[model samples]
Target: MSYLQKPSYYTISLVVVLLLPFTILFASFLLPFSAYLRGPPPIAAGSVVAGGCSHGAADGGGGGGGGGGVRPEISILVGVHTMAKKHSRRHLVRMAYAVQQTAALRGAARVDVRFALCARPMPPEHRAFVALEARAYGDVMLIDCDESPDKGKTGSSAEDVTTGTWLNMGNKAKNRVNIFPRMYDFKGVKPEDFLEDTIGVHQLKQDLRWAQTLEHFNVTWLDPSSKMTNSLLS
Candidate 1:
């Protein structure tokens, strides 16, 4: 035990063995306390995304992350009723909406465009593709019904069943205005028909037709540092 003598291997091993458990215990207590001081991670912007196709909402995850900010003044949800087979058109429609999310629009209102699909009769391949697509876009809803436009299986407003009918009740009519020929276009969408004012274009089911229509409004991504290319339709 001379002060100048080098410690033996046995002595060194004994010292380390005695200190190891204490070191581990200190870390175990300190790690959680440090994490607690940091607080829970901030919830991502657009984390609560997607509306269900059925009457109820379907919970899922995966979306872009950003810091929180003041809620937009207005919130609008445009639900497009579609079949599961139209995958390409869905992508085009998503791109169309995404590009239109300009700085001005983001500041004033939050517009979410989600697709509704009938889930009952979906084919195996369609189901798999729809699941992946919903996960990727976070905007698809699967309706539990047969895929039929005439069956009225899509959905209905609960107010419709109330004793008071809106149509004939004069002043009791629902607080809504017709958007046709103004905010929405029900007519078949053409390439030249894509206008800056219209909020929606309907009946563009054909892939080529939809692509052409989107090409009219597709804004070219020009940032040199970014890898995104111009519209594929071009």
Candidate 2:
């Protein structure tokens, strides 16, 4: 018998043309199905996120036997009643409070120190300086009053009300006052009256006295590499 006849060129071309569309279709379906079998891509490392428990659960002692319970936060607002003319004093006072804001203390207590001023008449330069200071510090309040301390500028509770409105202290938490804990350098206060646990030292009208007070309280001196330094003491 003779060898099988070789396929003709026209027959081979016809076979390729008929199978072209089916091959393309099969490849399209197979590509996506293969990807599906491989499963969804992983989330980016930076895109991952987590959440914490609610304040109610945190404060109510959280779930049983969880030693990593959240610490209850204490919010304190220390309003320093000062005149608009005291710009340098304000800077010093800001440093005095800012330096004391240790990380450990900040983790537990949210202490907001604000300077309260009166809407009294002042020079244009003074007003501009006050505006600049307020913008820079974001902790100054101008109360609607124009009178000296003797004329009852601070004797009324208007400042307190204004402060409450400014701070949005309308929450349900019951407020308590502790004016005694703060150090007031009035004539009645003596050296022996200084307490190690005093919250603050008021009436520090003199820079030398302020430096001394801060030095006394910051007995545990700040770290050598610390950026926060008491310029007054320096």
| lDDT by residue (tens digit), candidate 1, 65-154 | 211456677766666767789887677766666666655666677666678788878889988899887756677877677876556444
Segments in model 2 whose C-alpha atoms lie over 4 Å from true places: 1-72, 150-174, 179-193, 219-234
Please report, in order, the local distance difference test score of every candidate based on alpha carbons.
0.62, 0.61
For each candidate, what TM-score against the reference? 0.54, 0.51
lDDT of model 1, residue 227: 46
After superposition on all C-alphas, the RMSD of every candidate to the true structure, in Å, is 14.8, 17.0
lDDT of 2 by residue, 1-234 (tens): 545888889999999999999999999999998998899676542221111223222212211111233543676666677787888887776666665655566566656556777778777887888777655555666777874765444655566566566456565335656577564553323456677668656567777767677666664477766666555357
Give residue 42's error in model 1 in angstroms. 12
Cα RMSD for predicted model 2:
17.0
Look at candidate 1 and give me any clashing residue pairs: none
Lowest lDDT 10-residue stretch of candidate 2: 58-67
